[model samples]
Target: MYQTTSKKTPWIFCKDIINHPQKAMAWVWGYISCKHSMMYTLFVYTLLLILVLLYYVNHRESEPNHDETFKAKVQQSFIKFVEENMPKRDQNKETRAVYSMRTMSSNGSLLEDEHAKILKQRAGDIQREYIGFKNKKPFNFHCDKCAVVASSGQLLHSNSGQEIDNATCVIRMNNAPTIHYEKDVGARTDIRLVCFRSIDFMNKDTLMIGKARFDKMVIWGMENPKHKKIKETFTSKFIRKYPGVDYYSLSNSGEKKATRLYEEYLGMDRLKSNSWLSTGWFTMLFAVNMCDSITVYGLPDGNQCSAGSKKSILYHYYEKRYDECWMYNQHETRMKTGHRYLTEKAVFKQWAQMFNISFKAPAWNLTNVNASEPIKSPFISKMEKIGKKRTKR
Candidate 1:
């Protein structure tokens, strides 16, 4: 019999001792595991905090507050301030007056009743050439003294100013608002005929810009705006109210005849004649119809203006370069073809010599005001001598 004492008995089985540990030992292992996990979490949090701090410092350095640098201060105070205070120069006045004078002068006499009635009756005649009226009344027109002025690029800086001004009627196209040394452009023109094809040719304020009382003629080449169906079209809505304004159409026969003459006789490879043909041809036609003799000026001379580094001179319509200038090629081509047509003008001039039709060129020079004998044509020797005497005075 085993006597049981008050002390607790221990079961020391090897398997039980190996498999199970005391409560204190298990608690110690759990505490060590939790401490390791906490250390890892703290390490990750510290790294993230460091990255955020670095980003904040870099961002703060990149952007600065106002009043920081010399570059900004100079841009704000000096450069921009100076630009705001600069003044623009005004346009020259003589140029303005010349154009004003051109538009102001107007003198055109309509065909008298007898002449008009005759022309109307013969409108369908289909004759070889136009025949003059049978009992032709004496026309007040002094066509023998007629002059035509044209602006060419070749005339720029050419100092040919006085010669240009001496003409009876200086005809120019699309006269721009004048500026320094260009006052003669406006002042010398006695008549202004506004030629139009598209509405884009002139602005609504063109009449106001010239500020002169001039006769305005609207030419509707092949493109007639009034016939088109579109509303607000350029031709239909244009308001041309000054006196002496008239609208006329070229007969299909006239156009065909002119085109055939140009291509067959003049050797123009291109089938079409541009604005120059339309206007130049029309001008010639009108002159033939109304005037006994007509003189031409400012037509193309085929000499181009030289480019300068310091100054830019505006050229006459046909004289400007083909690429850079607007509405120029058509005029140039027309001029070349029309020049061929006017070859007969030399013959006409010879005929005028016998009949006493005076043809004169101007004698003024922009470069040399004191220079003598600016007239270049041999046919007008007497006129040149007179011009020289006038210049001397």
Candidate 2:
């Protein structure tokens, strides 16, 4: 009986409410007003959620970054941190990253010597004339005025062609075409940096076409021990065999600071693992080593990936990139594979502060005080003087 009464209590209350007509009318009015207010509040929250969703979806392209100065400052700090510890400064020859020599496993590196040798020997004899990399110290080459040209669509109308040409050496990444893009990217490609994975598909015919142009071809990703076929094929079968082509492989030998920068700043997770750094970063690294006065062209300035009303271009010229660098979530994978370009720029800014480096991006305003040139190397300055005299003569 008690249980039954508990269940009927709500009904008794309703009956009581119904019997008192005036009170019931007042209660109904209060309920109506309260319910209307609650629904209105709920409707406002739903609208806000929709707006947030819209912002999240299109934030990459629609926003225009106005705080380039602040961005530059932040990037400079990254540069300082990376510079204090990078490029692997081991004193022992066997331990350091050998930029001056061919990356053969037989060369007796303390780390990769055994695996590389085994792969090379297993490759056996191939039908090629010039099979070995020139042991003569990175083409016995150095340039005072070098330009590392990135394939950002920002280069499309940058009018940096002349500036690129003016450099003693111009380093380009992948098949960044210069035929039609000569006006924008310049026709002079002194060095072309290709990742080893992409070169495996190229036939002798394709390589022969490029042979007529690019002076020195540097193949990266040779350091990845997983891709043994790329190393074997490049060294043993197809690449070095090409006559008049000086092909060398670059290994991924980074220091702890750089690794931390990738993990902490660039969002790369595994700090100690051997992963493929972007060709752009390594390309810039190579340029800094050889060139006295280095100018980087077409890389996205601080504006591309900035939040809250910032604008950016997807490509340097008209590149067909498989990496979804134009999107936000792609930044998630960048920490793993080293494709987080905007984040990597932090390191580049720090690197520029170390040597004779200058940046030439699309949106560089005259007011940016960080846009100053470093001192030129005496050797490079002399080379530039000689080049100028030759032109005048």
Candidate 3:
């Protein structure tokens, strides 16, 4: 009966509260007010949690945040390797000779001669126009001392990175990688000179690596059928996706001038020869015009072309097995289509004497062109091998 009476008492109280709604509300409100501080804190915490969740979702949708950790790690690993394997060279640093542009003089024999004047007049407009991408204004830049790094196999195991990085500006050629080989080739890439044919390869490297390794890219070559195909496919897509990369191209007039310069240097007609001027040719010209003091690395000097003296090295620093001398010989001997590599080396020797240019990594003796021997023909080499076998017998 006591348990029954207790249950009935609670029910009677609930019935009174249900009948008098104002009293029930007053009781509930009094209880809430007494715990107001705790309730407010819980509400504020919930609101903050919702805001934090929204921020996290927004951040995740954007570019994957390595927060530059990936780039840093890559650099760090390469740096460690360099320190362990090839210590930096701080002694006997190479010095640059003072050079200044000669002004117009009455002698007319120097650079400001009538012919030079005409060429400058033609190039004046194009030189000033930087040609930025994505409707951005082009920035002006200059390098007092520039290092033009080549992709020759001579660079392998050279440990020339420290010296190359000391330059004011470093220019790299098409599709040459400095990531893994940063110890041999400097980690700095101020400008990349790419030909039309190599643009697709460069883009592929960029896409696969998920990073643009160069600051500025200057493309040269005629807008041929192949280039048109690349433009419609890779180039357009690259420009749209990577607006941060500064893209520039040499004008038709500029290319013509460069070709003319090559002709003048080689003392031959390019069309008649049916030969391609090596990229090194254009790269040297660019260095002459853009940089005050130029130092070239990894290009075989004229003396190295001789049969006896030629060091057996790979055609490219990255390529392991291809013989550099053999390839040069094959290309130089091609009757219809080939680069006159030996001839070009002779021309470069002449230019080195004239300009404030110097070569290293099998350095050049600019005084003499006597040692610039032609690469021996592959057939002749084969016949010589056969003769040697007979002699052994």
lDDT of 2 by residue, 157-180 (tens): 778888899888888887666777
lDDT-best of 2 and 3: 3
Per-residue lDDT tens digits for candidate 1, residues 1-393, read 998665211223223323553543453344445556666445445544665687699988887855556434533343332232211101343322222211111111122243234332332221223221222222122233444444544344544446545655444444432334343343444444334443344443543235433433323233334544321343344434322333233334544554443332222222222113434444443443443445554443221211212333334433344332223322332222222223223222322322323332322122321111111222123222433454456
Q: Which residue ranges in model 3 land beyond 4 Å of their true spot?
A: 1-130, 135-140, 205-212, 222-226, 369-393
Per-model lDDT = 0.35, 0.52, 0.60
**lDDT for each residue of candidate 3 in 1-393, tens digit (9 for 90 to 100):** 455433223346446545774575564454446545675445445544665687689888885758566644543443343243222221212110000111111122334244334433433433444355544453356689999999888888888899998999998888887877877877888888778777766765542233335678776773444456765664568776656667876655666667665554333346544568777776776676677788998888635656465457877887787887777776665444567776677656655654567887757776543222211333224323433454456
Model 1, position 29: C-alpha lDDT score:
46
Which has the better lDDT: candidate 1, or candidate 2? 2
Residue 177 of model 1, lDDT score:
28
Please report the candidate that would top TM-score against the real structure.
Answer: 3
| Model 3, C-alpha of 24: deviation from truth (Å) | 99
